[model samples]
Target: MAKQSTLDKNILHFLGPKHWLTWLGMGIAYALSFLPWFIQKFLGKALGNLHRALSPNRRHICDVNLHMCYPEMTIKERQSLTKAHFESMGIGVFEMFATWFQDRSKTISKVSFHNEDVVEKALSKGKGCIIIGAHFSSIDLCGTHMARYIDVHPIYKLQRNPVMNWVMERQRRKIFSKTIERRNVREVIKSLKQNKAVWYAVDQDYGRKNSVFAPFYGHECATISHISRLAKSTQAAILLYDYGRTEKGYFLSLTELEDYPTGDEVQDATKINQLIEQQIEPKKAQYFWSHRRFKTQAIEGTPSPYSK
Candidate 1:
């Protein structure tokens, strides 16, 4: 493990500064996205033309997810949706940069909040709740906006680029100073004890030893057990939050999980996982399907639905 850490550090050092790349990419994308309505329309049409000509990996990811989640979808319908998904992903990339680089008012105006009472109620109890978030549309802004109403401690997996990490750390701290690394389990526990809300993006590919197989999109996938463990230890209420894009703009919604900490850890985790799936199902195109979510397989001799 020490050797692996050293290798990782060396690789990051080799990459050197990444802040310049981030700035250049973000600046160009934001400017393009904010062009005049007529100009932006032309640019969008041109991009659509290019999209039809090129075969992006995002298309494949969308197709795979659609196939897995909606086996009943006809191939033609799936293809059409996959095309729209890639276009949306492209637009979302630019929207992400615009949100990150632009002023808070401009970005926050694009998102609407719903069921804020859920968070207020949790905080009112003075025990702080665990917010389980996923990488859906405009997810980063969810934490940013929530911070305006209450203190939110979000967990992030640091990047390899030291310079880029420093830049992002500064930007993130502007809204949330209590950012914890994924490996800092002790720190997370301490924060919960202090009655601080901790936000976690639980839908990711954690290896077998650290995660348990859970059903997602009708397939068994390795899901993080940390949230369940923390809830069991601290008795914190579990709430799921997601941001979905609307025709007008973006909107945030919170769903409170029923019967949290019912003395069945696995069952509790399964329920939370199902709630996350339910949230993602309606906004399938916005979900980050590029991630290899089912990288870890079920144990040998078990019927693995996700074996690809």
Candidate 2:
């Protein structure tokens, strides 16, 4: 954990003002979202053109993810999907700014919910539940919508930009007072004990020691152990929540993972990984393919070209 913290600190230092660039980009994106529907649509289309012109390294990451998850897809099919993926990414960028900048009531009104009873049931149990989500199409909006039903304490990895981080923290704190840092395990556990729902994006690559290798899209990747440990320790019900984009905007789907493994740590973590993959399979384009998901590979062999 100490090593991972050091690594994150170093990476943050290296990235430096790149975080400000993201905020600047987001500022433009947020303004674009409020444009006329036709204008927003046109901007989305233009993003596809820019994505197509990406250099080899950037394009390779997208290509590798597509090939790995959809091995049966022909090159043409994969390329088409990749383009669509970029278009969605562009839209998502704009959506994030819209979500953060817009009024909470307006943003929440744009999203609908299904199977909210699943959450109600978990809360009724008197033990706070862990809501496991991923980098799906409208993940940011999911947290906003969820705030209407329950107090969601989301753990976020702080960004490098002091100014932007201040803005984001203020925005999120409007809905969740318990927005703890990812490294603060103690605070997370305390929130769970208080029966407060906690949200986590467990799909990211947490280096070797902190994570165990688990199968995701037929590849063994490092999976975070915190979810399993938290669930077992606090006796918290685990729920899978994903946001799917629709013509109207976004909708949240909540499912109870009653079948989550509990005995063996390795098997338990793998079960969670599989559940995430299953949820994402139907909405492959919604998943964040641009992320380095397979950064840490299993031993005994090299990672496939598609890995990460």
Candidate 3:
């Protein structure tokens, strides 16, 4: 057998008594996975309410985003939307639980696919596909559920908590056809060449590198630009895979973009932001509003609108 390295020993040490609370939280989430759908929804909203009450800074970030994006919205309307965002976020947590412990067949049977012909056509092109994913509520569950329909490889990030990271990797591997590290450009290209759909969330800002400052929701926001490169190199089609929750279960939509990667990076990025807005408009609260979306301003040295 291979000898465990020093880093492995330290991981074992930290995963022991040093992380009791983390373990307890994971345990509770696991146990909650078996609750009936209706009850789980109630408890999830309650948990979200509790979290909203405790997290003022996060709430402030959401408020700032709403003010920027929905300048026309009444303060009352924005406040209501904030509450719904948190509640949906809480319910999203339990959705992860449902995905981890519940029966995949039964859970997926509840999902309805729309405009699936879009994907059918995209795959028919013989080039790979890059799914324009987003950070929406129930992100974990939605990403996992998506693989059921298409042979998708999710571009994943490592959880900050090492112990939880292991858990996430294990769970993703179980549901996803394959998991690709967010930085593994080679694997992404290879998968696309194989005509497999790769899920890529281009909404987040990862500093200025390979990113362009563009107007998103009426604010100058940093947008990832390498997507244009990826699509160009792989000759892969870019499709939007939108997820929505109804009273029954969930629904996903596959939308094929026309005239994308116009060979202009900024134009393509702007189009992405535009498409994301369309996706969020119908389900405002189901989107992740608490993220510091405008952290990186358009101009260098410009102060972030969000409070520290």
Clashes of each: 0, 0, 0
Candidate 1 lDDT over 1-308, as tens digits, reads: 12111212433453436356765654576677565434543454456436645855545655676788789999998877666655555555555444456556756666788898998777676677888878874565556677776677888887665544554565677767577777888878888777888888888877887787778877777888777778877877777877776767678777677777677656765776787787877777667765667667777566433343
Q: For candidate 2, lDDT tens digit of each residue in 128-238? A: 989988887567766777888778899888766454565566678776766878889898889888888898988998788888887888888888876887788788899
TM-score of each: 0.81, 0.85, 0.93
The runs of at least 3 residues in candidate 1 whose Cα sits more than 4 Å from the true structure, single-residue gaps closed, are 1-23, 26-58, 300-308
**For candidate 3, which ten residues in a row score worst on lDDT?**
1-10
TM-score of 3: 0.93
**Evaluation by TM-score, superior candidate among 1 and 2:** 2
Give the alpha carbon lDDT tens digit for every residue of 1-308 in model 3: 22222222344654678688887888888888978888999999999999899999989999999999999999999999999999999999998887776766757767888887788899999998899867888677767667777889988776667657656666777888788888889989899888999998889878888689888988878999999888988889999878878777888888988887899998889989988998898889998899988998778988889956
Q: Give the clashing residue pairs of candidate 1, or none.
A: none
Model 3, position 5, has a per-residue lDDT of: 21
Q: Model 3, residue 185: displacement in angstroms? A: 0.9
Per-model RMSD to reference: 4.5, 4.6, 3.5
lDDT of all predictions: 0.68, 0.75, 0.84
Q: What ranges in model 3 sit over 4 Å off?
A: 1-14
- Whole-model lDDT for model 2 versus the true structure? 0.75
User: At residue 139, what lDDT does model 3 achieve?
Assistant: 76
Ranking 1 against 3 by TM-score, winner: 3
